[model samples]
Target: MSEHNEGDLFRQFVGDVKPLKQTVRGDKRPAAKDTPGLIERRRAAQELGNKEGNYLARQEHISPVKPWDLLSFKRDGVQHGVFRSLKQGKYVIDATIDLHGRTVQQARQEVFHFLRECVERDIRCATITHGKGQHRDPPALLKSCVNHWLQQMDEVLAFHSARPQQGGSGSTNVLLRKSQAQKDKNSEKFNRKTSRK
Candidate 1:
């Protein structure tokens, strides 16, 4: 082909290959001015303050009685009825009391001693794994005895059948009276830790 003809053909090819440019026009609404409702809402929210508007605000307005704020022993008195179901943690004792192994008198002393120790240790909650007395033919001697013993103990705030995860009906969950030192230490620890954190 001739140079002039080839140059014209190349120009035509370049023109055809080039893509068309596009411009986008946006149909946007104008920025909204502050309406009366919006202004009022802002004013009301600000006027309400944190304390007036929120549920937690009311809680803050009224002095809260923290778990550690009240006297442990005094608070325990009020919680005497509800504590059994409320507390679920474990306080295990290495020593086990077997009713079958001991005489009636010995068993009574053992029960008293165990309860006293629990109170002294400031153990709010503990489990007495009194075996279900499966071997006892007619009735569960240990189970019945533990129930009776717990009922008699003044220091036993409350007692109930333990959760299935925690020995189930075989064990009794016992809530005991808090000792002075335990109560004080717990309150001090809670105050120090909770306030700072």
Candidate 2:
């Protein structure tokens, strides 16, 4: 009974007191600066990007496959009928570029840039009119350059001389490989069709 009474007295004594405030911290370390190695690495990456950007902005060297001659190539393992279809002008031409009288340098840049855009837009078939170099003493300078450049790019699946209505041998019809996105979309459709069946 005495112990219970003492306990009640102690609780009453402690109940009215306020709690103490917490101590706020005053000192904090500042954020870390980049180390010397990190800074050097960042600078090197930036310089490389600038160099590549400059290379793209200016002339890209084009090695002619063969000067002033019919030029053609296809990456190996392409299905046999694909090239033949292009040669037959079976694919509808989705885009066209005329390179008449442009310098080889200008034509090279334009052709690459245009083809890049075409692939992005999912264009598969295009016609490039390089002109037969008819009036030139040598003949077919742009034609040859265009041919060589097209062969060099992996995007070009096949090309052949267009018919009389399409500028004949002077202008080549090009078949570009389908973009990966386009191919994936087609595969998805195929899968869906098979799944339904």
Top candidate, metric TM-score: 2
- C-alpha lDDT (0 to 100) for residue 189 of candidate 1: 96
Give lDDT tens digits, candidate 1, residues 6-96: 9999998897686768978679656567689956754554444443422221111222222111111123354544653434434453333
Candidate 1 overall lDDT versus native: 0.55
lDDT of 2 by residue, 119-196 (tens): 989999899988777667445667766766777777888888876678777778888888989999999999999999
lDDT of 2 at 171: 79
TM-score of predicted model 2? 0.63
Per-candidate TM vs. native?
0.45, 0.63
> In model 2, where do residues sit more than 4 Å from their true spots?
1-70
